[model samples]
Target chain A: MRVLALLDGTPADPDAPLIRVDDLGLLRGDGVFETILVVGGEPRELGPHLDRLARSAAMLDMPEPDLAAFRRAVDLVLGTWSGGPEIAVKLVFTRGVEGGDGTPTGFALGMDISPKVIAQRAGGISAVTLERGIEPGLAERAPWLLLGAKSLSYAVNMAALREAERRGADEVVFTTSSGSVLEGPTSTLVLARGRTLTTPPSTLGILPGTTQAALFRAAERAGWSVEVAPVDVAELYPADGVFLVSSVRKITRVHTLDGKALPDSTGLHTVLDGLYESEY
Target chain B: MRVLALLDGTPADPDAPLIRVDDLGLLRGDGVFETILVVGGEPRELGPHLDRLARSAAMLDMPEPDLAAFRRAVDLVLGTWSGGPEIAVKLVFTRGVEGGDGTPTGFALGMDISPKVIAQRAGGISAVTLERGIEPGLAERAPWLLLGAKSLSYAVNMAALREAERRGADEVVFTTSSGSVLEGPTSTLVLARGRTLTTPPSTLGILPGTTQAALFRAAERAGWSVEVAPVDVAELYPADGVFLVSSVRKITRVHTLDGKALPDSTGLHTVLDGLYESEY
Candidate 1:
């Protein structure tokens, strides 16, 4: 079977079967995953990505893996064939095969070639706010269950993106049923109100973003206000600027929401670009 | 590295590596995983496991894997592996690896040797209810995010179970602070009152368990009433009989919870044991 293999930053053979699962993704959605973007032949924000990976691994009950080994593996790929343009890097982990005898089969890990680069919307993505569709307060109570950690079991986020795609938009800006804005499916939602850049608190079960964290620091250093607060979807469209931030696509501006066009903001682009320069 | 390989159910070399993630499980936690028990040389209830894996894969936005080969792999192992009273089987999948050009590397998969089975418990598991600690109604709202599907991102469930185990019980029974019961880390809660067998509704975001579904069928054929409804942790100590059901151990009678021993209901045990019967 042909398979897509992602080593570090380069794309590999597509026909080699590289993965097999009993559909653990279907059975329990019992894993965490990561997506890193490669730009100019380098992985962006490796430190933050590793930090988030550690946080996510702790959430899944696995021992913290050797970070040095992880770095080495990525470095190994980098030292070999590099595309040097742009590409998506995917990382996935399961609980390992478990049950019956209560023993662990080793974990299945793989890299996949993804969209070389997200289509950069000329202005930004138009998004719709769904009620987040989750039971209230459970994410907080089950925080230890790794609510904020990026897991391989990302059905809804995938669906949200699909929903966005369906709506002819780039992504969904998740909101509580009660109307509080959460974040995007794959990226952290940051609002630029004049000069202040704000995102939902990670404590609220949004997976902490290495890219967003770095951007916030850069924003603060750039003398831009950065806040982590509860945001309402209703107010998002009117914000001076709105964007999605992640390790791969450092910042993608939002163009429209619910068919309504949003105003332009270059301030966010400036701060985020500086962050990209220093990191990626 | 040594690995016990099973293609469907057939056994292969043990001293060789059938898959390698380069320890990707340590990197991004990017994969889906499952564990099945070998019963009398036959794999128990594999269809449900594959289904769960598919659901999780969809959640991760990976292509749906063809599980037909998995069934054959299990058969391959059962046809070989020759030694065991009973054993556990593990299956895992990753996104494969990527190259320095930012493409996916080959995928890695491995089957683990069974762990020693030592089912020990005097009684049922006791759970402490946390209010799910997040926004209200997140589970009901966000079904797409896989509140109920089993995913490898189980760091928190393991922690929750560890927390429960630390408190002197078997597994953690998760509940929303709203007073609605979710489920245990790994098993679904089955309770009985007289001849009535009951569990929680999946609308609450619990992974639909194949074992539980089989139990429901078994209970009804045995002329016991079966009901799937919302349950709270408080209902446990008062149930006539309680047991946690999974693929491997089949059924383990819960003995003590929060130091309080639950009463033995012949009805519960009868149904529990009856479930293993090939004709139940």
Candidate 2:
């Protein structure tokens, strides 16, 4: 079953035409969105996702989103959702119709998690490093680039995924021009070395991964050391474990890099998986 | 008055809802578009704009757009349009609805040129040089960056324009990290030194400006020299003339750069304007 709700907490027909053609979100991709996982009709990490949505809107110079309205929309959708093991809830906020009033467009949609995403989580994925063409330190200085903002302008990310498909990989791990490992197109990179877990800092202009933060918190309680630092592309090959994490997918191990098999980290994977399950 | 048309050449209500909420064009900015200036109900440079649209689609790995259908839509919109001095015709083709059949979505919208656009063309504009964060030549090697494709993923471009406004400028001239001049967010940079006209080449991964190409053809016919080369940001300050060109705006002189006044080039401007008029 699918459920859709407007920002005002009004339920909408999911199959009907919704957004206007001239909406800036459709015209120029001037929008922000969040994808959250819902288990047993309960949305996970809704607070963080809404916070990120507001942060993204702020970065785009848009007015602050009404978190209460978004929360109502989410609750409305969840109220209508039929029983399901998992659903991916998406929240979208746009700059509204072009040449019209300044009111923004917003929506909430709840749908089943894709089988591929679930399969990837269970069996892991292969990724290839693709140069993002931006220098490592440039994004922090260039605010206009909107580097860390998870806006709807994801054509490059989609293109990178297509490139990964062309290279016979399932996913892409974007790297800076100088070979610093940045993050996945839609996920965060997590590296395990011995008892320590490392993730690249958000200061590198990558999205601060919500799921990764949750996992780090859980792991910390479980006695796993956590570190946020710059990561090098070369370190992936020699790391004790490498994984990609997202809200919907939860956690996915990286089994191969550039067609070469990575060393198995089944023990670490089990530990991380248990940690995530225990907390979430 | 505004006119809207579907790909099948059917007219639609401009005030009505059109695109579905799940359309990938709005969801992920997976789309390509073209804007053509219609003067006296005739679209200027329709052929070149359509060609560029197809090229952009190819770069995005999207299916080749049916140019005949787009042409029909444009004709339909113009036929319905009441008399106007100028109209901007926008054609959009998107990857269709997410999780649906593989058909594409297309539309043509014709609306009046904004007064601000007309005013800018008549009085010129001031621009600030903002670093694009990408290194020079990196775009050529990183095809996934979608540098030249005019995709709907323009949030960064919009953000840069906002940044320009914050700096008390009307427009933004994007520059590479190393200070090589790129193009404007929505236009092409044209520099005049002595009797020669220079524009940065598409090899720099900038869009091959359709208006600039037409201007160059006119310039060549007028016995002026034209050169396509890498331009430095410094050239704008000392050049005999600097201008931004787009299909709708046509030609706009750059009166100031980073708040400093630029030299006036009335003679060159008149010559170029006459040349454009004579040809178009």
Candidate 3:
């Protein structure tokens, strides 16, 4: 693993102690983060990831991110991990030490993708639907809720995934209080039915998935129609195919929902994988 | 500020960077925390705070916290700041470096209470009611959401408070989607109706407040009726008095709700303050 800390746009020694216990990011989980895949020592989908990071920072009322500082840190960390297998480069920016000038703490870390995530891509995953406790169409009215912002307060998301695992499932798809399919805990829910691809709209309080956005762009070029629509849980089971899309995991087919198998993805995987591979 | 990092029953250097970047507490906000008021070098309401911490740890599936380790760290940190004005001592425990043996990381830090929070006690806070984005009765069914747990994912709570300030208010009182008053961002909601005190039930997904619990016990002994019930926002405006109760802020009366002055809290404050002081 390689890490580089960006102190006010300057790269600091990775081995030196950097984070203070008083950082609001650690103390109150007040921060924003983005994970980009590095292929051949280069950050993939850099533009979209940086854009989302800035948006998250704005939602959290943190100062606008210094993208140049982020780029420097990413470049340094990736260089340190050169020649490694594909790595996940994570960019984190937090409200700095409390009672200070509120300078943001920014850093980048590069590490090999978790084997478990890689396995999910190859084996597909069994997903269970869980209630997200909030009703649909509430995100817009409650900006203070920090909906659609990828804030670091992800304990609920992690807990939902753990709940799925305890139920003998590998992943989770969250549904709103109204029984509408929202999105996966860490991934976007994209469904395909008869050549049309559909994903839940970000207006429903889901993080706009970077990989899903990339995949949609690629899929569109490959002559597939993509739509952002509200999906009900009942619609997922009847869909011809469903997949969870994320940056690190890329595109993963949901082999089963609850306990029943969805349609197999023999040809769809070939087409989607080719699109993802040809992107860079 | 005095800080101590406890590693498995041992006190480590406070200035040494204790948390790794990969700590799930920082990465996923997978942690629990408590802030207790230290008066004259003694932690007030220690038993209830620890009990709440243990409950929070259990809600997050963390290993049992070694209370002995916590006590030792607190003692050392408090001793470091002996004779200082009353301070706020914070305890944080997180599921340590992810994918490891799940060894928890614990720490204690003592700092003088923020002048702003101390000022609130003198100048009562103007509060606003904001929608909490969830129904009142959903927490029990959605344990995965960790609604009642004082998990570290306080981004939304903090955001709500910021939203209130932006609207020219001093604090926030969260209301459920059904219009029931929930709690403050970091405090418990307590409303005074004559000699009876009512608080929103914990079943409504609000954290069970340590200071609020202590206040209720003290109130009962002083001939005040305490009821744990769900309060609607409508009732707050007509109440005899309203207050946001927390350990650090002690018992702060809410002077206004949504720009409208609540009833003057002369008698209620006298009684509650007397009860609070008599307890300690």
Candidate 4:
């Protein structure tokens, strides 16, 4: 909720003394965004965040913005920030708030830097299933309606997260009403098997995440198999290791779910965090 | 789309300089807006629009803006305009783009007067039955998600409209997957039976329309029965009359759906349009 308002390249008064007409993202919720952790003024997963941003924009049918300029905007704010230590940087890019007649205009981008990180809870996160993520039709038949886009229309996503938090958990994992596992609100779902680190395939309409990519490489280096497959709720709860992966809070482990304790292993979390820090 | 940008109350450069963070509606999509049709430099439905804007803010859990000041800002723009035949006026209010963590800061209020009007077709509209309107569970249990408030998170609503337009319709009427009729992408769905003009109830989660309320009043004065009830796709195609209602384009007739011609209702369209203009 704490955000820095970046208008053009300069940080403006959060009270942007403006009677603005267009904010398509905030209006129709018509845009895409990303959240990257800034560690010592460097964005945590630049390449991956940009990659997902482009994909989500396409899903929303928005005319893509200049990705390079967007990256520079992030860096410009990071360059000027004097806040000590590390913080989460959130970038929101929306199709300018006009043209409901179906023609897209330019885009509006806002950046919020150094959000207070809830230091990773030592014991790990507790989560529960939410049916909001279910696709009503067959996967092949479901039109990708904002599913792939990290559009500013994220009220439901935030709502689901709150639902999980209210239930005494740090995060929530989305599930189909049929109980098939979907991804976390802002993170990718990943778990370790006997020797394999597995996550859901992107074709399941989940955002293709950069953190999971890096972890895949890390898993390879640790002599583990990496597979992208559909995972079920039953399988997730009993996994050898469970965690949610994102750019800022690299790897948050799930210690419990629905009142049951998940068998834990710090091996995946430690190794993944180590890899994320060293590489990015 | 061409637009005009104003800051606070002054006309400023679109690229005006600013501070770094505005954690307002931009990040959370926490805002509400209304687009009114300006007829002869006068806002046609200012009272109803402001009423709905306040309702949308309250639904999304944000405080309402000062309507006296908001109307003043809108009037300032309208008063200055040289008389035009007609124009579109948009009013936007955000929890003034900065404040709390995952909470509303305040809101930004912006208004734009555009030279646009609803592009209605000569004969009328055709539509497709998209099953994506209301989620199955919420459609029955939590009607709260669908009724009344006009929040800015409208990606899917716009998408449904786009899909209808693509199929050569001016607008679309959404149907439940199980075949119950919902409302249009941006208008209320109505069926006329003899002297009765019936629309779907807000209990079904349709955005209640100022225009629809006017229609109900006019129908009553004309000695017609006015009803609000659920209809199915079959009833829509075989109805005594069908129309989409909104602020600017008060009543657009639905002439065809799929390939079947609706029973010709020239009498209904003429009666409705006359009542809409003279009374509404």
Local distance difference test scores for all models? 0.60, 0.91, 0.85, 0.65
For every candidate, C-alpha RMSD to the true structure in Å: 6.0, 1.0, 1.6, 4.5
- In CAPRI terms, model 4 is classed as acceptable
Which sequence of candidate numbers ranks them by lDDT, best first? 2, 3, 4, 1
lDDT of residue A263 for candidate 3: 81
Q: Is candidate 1 or candidate 2 better by lDDT?
A: 2
Where does candidate 2 chain B have its weakest 10-residue lDDT segment?
B132-141
Q: Output the lDDT of residue A206, model 1.
A: 78
Comparing 2 and 4 on TM-score, the stronger one = 2
Order by DockQ, highest first: 2, 3, 4, 1
For candidate 3, give fnat to 2 decimals.
0.68
Clashes of 1: 134
Best by DockQ: 2
lDDT of 1 by residue, B4-53 (tens): 44434445554333434432322344445666766676666777788887
Better of 2 and 3 by DockQ: 2
Residue B234 of model 1 has an lDDT of 76
Q: Write the per-residue lDDT of candidate 3 for residues A30-123, one digit (tens) a residue.
A: 9999989988876788999999999999999999998987888888776667546798888888887778898887788777788899998888
lDDT of 1 by residue, A1-280 (tens): 1123342333344333333333333234545556666565577777777777777867766566555655655555445534546555555545544343322222212233334335563344567776565334547655565667776545456556766676677678887667877777778888889778889887766777787887888778777888988888778878988888776666778777778888766665665667646643
Tens digits of per-residue lDDT, candidate 2, B1-280, equal: 7899999879999889988889999999999999999988778889999999999999989989999999999999998998577999999999888898978899999999998998988888999999987666777889999999999999999999999999999999999877898899999999999889999988888899998999999999888999999999988899988999999988889999999999997677778878877776
